[model samples]
Target: MSLGDDTGQTRIRLPEGSDGDPYGGARRGGRSSSRSLVTVVGVVVLLIAAIAFANRGGDDSAAEEGAASADSPKAAATAPSGKKPVTTKAAGIPAGFTHDREGAQSAAANYAVVLGSAEMFTKARRDAILRSIIVPDRVADFEAELDKAYTPEFNKNVGLNEDGTTPKDFTFVSRTSPIGTKVTESSADTATVEVWCSGLLGLAGESSTNPVTSSWFTITIQLEWTSGDWKIVTHSQKDGPSPVPGDERASSADEMAKAVQEYGGFTYAR
Candidate 1:
């Protein structure tokens, strides 16, 4: 008895000296095995062909969708609006945004840039900026708040003179670049937007206490349709969805100063 033999099953023993081929002949046995192999191969080939056909159909669908996307206007969710950016300026800042959600977002983003700029350190420019962007009812309050905030002590702390002037030899670098904007809430006459920003600030000089550094922040702006344009009712800022610092060589003081002088900030953003 073999290890796998079933003791309860019946068995037939062939005559002595008979060929051991189960199909009674070697040729027949070989044929039976070949047929089994062919059947298995046929099934496998059919499965592969079916899979290839399904995948090819899926590819055609995807290609058609991509072509349609290329031919038609981009969906508002995935792309910026096609409306023209504001061409007008008031008080040296971009103004006259369209009366819509996109306009609100654009206004908010540009306002964030100017509000964070070096000009805001000076009282005269800061007041002008506030008057241009803030709603009429809020302008006085905003000016008063910012007046207390950009004090002489604060200016000195950030490497500026008490009067908000750069040192004789050093160049002051304070600029904000809006990364993106989103409207969180909206209506026919009001919108609330968030502007993600990256800012450069500090003094560009070899002997300066504060070297130029980058910071990330988000500004939330509440806006209203006022005087045929969007104006800020209130705005506040919070620190960053910051990314880890990259390993790049730092520029020399002269290089930093020259770059700041040569590279101008944008007038509009969206």
Candidate 2:
């Protein structure tokens, strides 16, 4: 959830650690001091392993492999199609990904990053993003539900105006970084992928009441091959494979803002 520079390292520093619960849902409560609290609980939340499919494992390495393998990258779990990553954005989001398991995972991972981004809070960008990634029939329901969730008061809670804009002197920060992607199921016409991600949410500046902070999550996106591309049918979130709180010293708001401005996010292929 820290600022990631082109070198793939976290450039932003955490100013402080917290003693309060980090699972506070943004919609249920007013924003608190811990800007690091889980902000966008995407489509849904379920702690139980939601995908009911055969997990890859064998007795010899079963104990060492089970849940660890869930997040870890293994050669057998990934395949290459000799296809180039999508280079175009349909409505500012990636589009025309290749039709295969890798393509599906790539779409899901990129979708996860966009869905949890600051852009999704605004009406215009949100609508465009939904139209580009979500399956057609579900678009209406998703848009209505999300519109209700990202209310004017919720915008205020996240340090934005009712119209989802930041005050003149402050910089808003809501970004998601996907660490890895895994396909849980796949075939010629449909696929499901889990995108492991960490995010930053809050505003950054000297006088800011809400400071940029971090959270960890995994998103499962079910996709279908339609209109010559993969589109989301459904998505859900679950809490961490989050690393234990680190002891690294936190950085100042100025440093955080500078890093965000200097760095550009990846298009996230593979």
Candidate 3:
């Protein structure tokens, strides 16, 4: 991932081309590349059609839709009104959060999305990203620990340049999109949330080192509603409840790289 500072906003750049296979597959090229892109596009199209059909049929599953109206800005507004849990942190930014369960869970889910993004791969960018999401008091500690984990050697191993930069011709793509969210436990002030995430990690370009591969992981967060918002107190992750692999062919390095450049990311909220 590449970090750029513009006017004052920070931007994270995805790899320009494809590289190493995180899933341990043989390097794919030529016909294989075209096939992969076609397959992915088809699957996405089918998914959209399926969702349209389901919604049009009035399959009102409350568990999935939660609130009756999709017009509301808050996706989780229909959450259960239980007790208002204790949400303040002894030393962190919880002093600014409101002590409400829904608010806390909302904050935790959004923060988790930011924390698990590709921007976390770079040192300076990673520090800023963490600082923006973590509780105020824990920012220093989190930064120190994260810095230790993101060593120069680690960056190289992950297909980054020694200086944690993306090569000019290559496009490194690391992203996580949340499929859904569940509040497993909730009280007046605390909640345990599970976010199902689909992630892509790879480099794309002619002669690149890391090709984009995909993975699924679930992130669990323990949250407390504090000050006036939700704050994450703890976080953990696990491999996945992945689906079976389809027989689609992989895309070429150049094609994948071009797509990355053409596309952008979204700001997700629960």
Q: Pick the candidate with the highest TM-score.
A: 1
* RMSD of each candidate relative to the true structure: 21.1, 15.8, 14.0
User: What tens-digit string does per-residue lDDT give for candidate 2 at 20-122?
Assistant: 4344333343545344334312211321234322353466457765757464657645444456668999988888888888888889978998999888988
Task: Indicate which candidate wins on lDDT.
Answer: 1
The count of backbone overlaps in candidate 3 is 42
Which regions of candidate 3 deviate over 4 angstroms?
A: 1-105
How do the residues 75-126 of candidate 1 rate in per-residue lDDT, one tens digit apiece? 4442665566788999889999989888898899899999899999999889
Q: Write candidate 3's Cα lDDT for 60-168 as tens digits.
A: 6555468645655356533544534335433232223345444555455556656766678877888766555555677788888878877888777767887778777
List pairs with backbone clashes in candidate 1: none
Q: How much lDDT does each candidate structure score?
A: 0.85, 0.81, 0.67
The per-candidate count of clashes, in order, stands at 0, 2, 42
Off by over 4 Å in 1: 1-78
Decide which is better by TM-score, 1 or 2. Answer: 1
